[model samples]
Target: MIDPEELGRALRATLAGFKVPRNIEIVDDLPRDDNGKIAKHRIRAHYADAGARTA
Candidate 1:
């Protein structure tokens, strides 16, 4: 399995310091829309619910 931190490290090495993501979520598959496109809004909504539902 790939370590997200190691991958983040590699990314940090290649990208500008400001471009690194603060948190890297390792989901089995990213949510997609009916048309099979990446759903950015869906991802955000899922993350947004992480704490709310837990709380």
Candidate 2:
């Protein structure tokens, strides 16, 4: 469980007045590329609005 509130507090104090990010998605690990680089495209897909789901 990621604490957005506490995270915001630390970030706010660090930056000192920059608006905190509203949607903070905390993940265990980020997608990486073959060369050991961050796969930004995969990250975007993961967060994409897949719309509402129903059981």
Candidate 3:
């Protein structure tokens, strides 16, 4: 498994260099249905409604 702290630093570094509104969203585990397909709608809602929910 990826180290959460290391991943956070790397992600922050990468996002910091980005210039597209600087809106970065990261999630540990995506919401999925019983079949395991990602629930894009839920992810979108979460991202859209509350900015980025960081670790």
Task: Please name the candidate that would achieve the greatest lDDT relative to the true structure.
Answer: 1
List clashing residue pairs in candidate 3.
Answer: none
Candidate models: Cα lDDT each: 0.88, 0.75, 0.68
Which digits, one per residue and each the tens of the lDDT, describe model 3 over residues 13-34?
A: 6776453344434557889978
Residue-level lDDT tens digits of model 2 in 7-30: 887888877564767667677988
Residue runs of model 2 more than 4 Å from their true location after superposition: 13-18, 51-55
Q: Candidate order by TM-score, highest to lowest?
A: 1, 2, 3
In angstroms, how far off is 3's CA in candidate 1?
0.3
Q: What RMSD does each model have against the real structure? A: 2.4, 4.1, 6.0
- What RMSD value applies to candidate 2? 4.1
Question: Lowest-scoring 10 consecutive residues by lDDT in candidate 3?
Answer: 17-26
Best of the candidates, TM-score: 1
- Which residue pairs in model 2 clash with each other? none
Candidate 3, residue 54: Cα displacement in angstroms equals 15
Error of 3 at 12 (Å): 12
Q: How high is the lDDT of residue 39 in model 2? A: 100
Model 2: lDDT to the true structure: 0.75
Best-to-worst lDDT order? 1, 2, 3
Candidate 1 lDDT tens digits, 13-37: 9999899998776778888899999
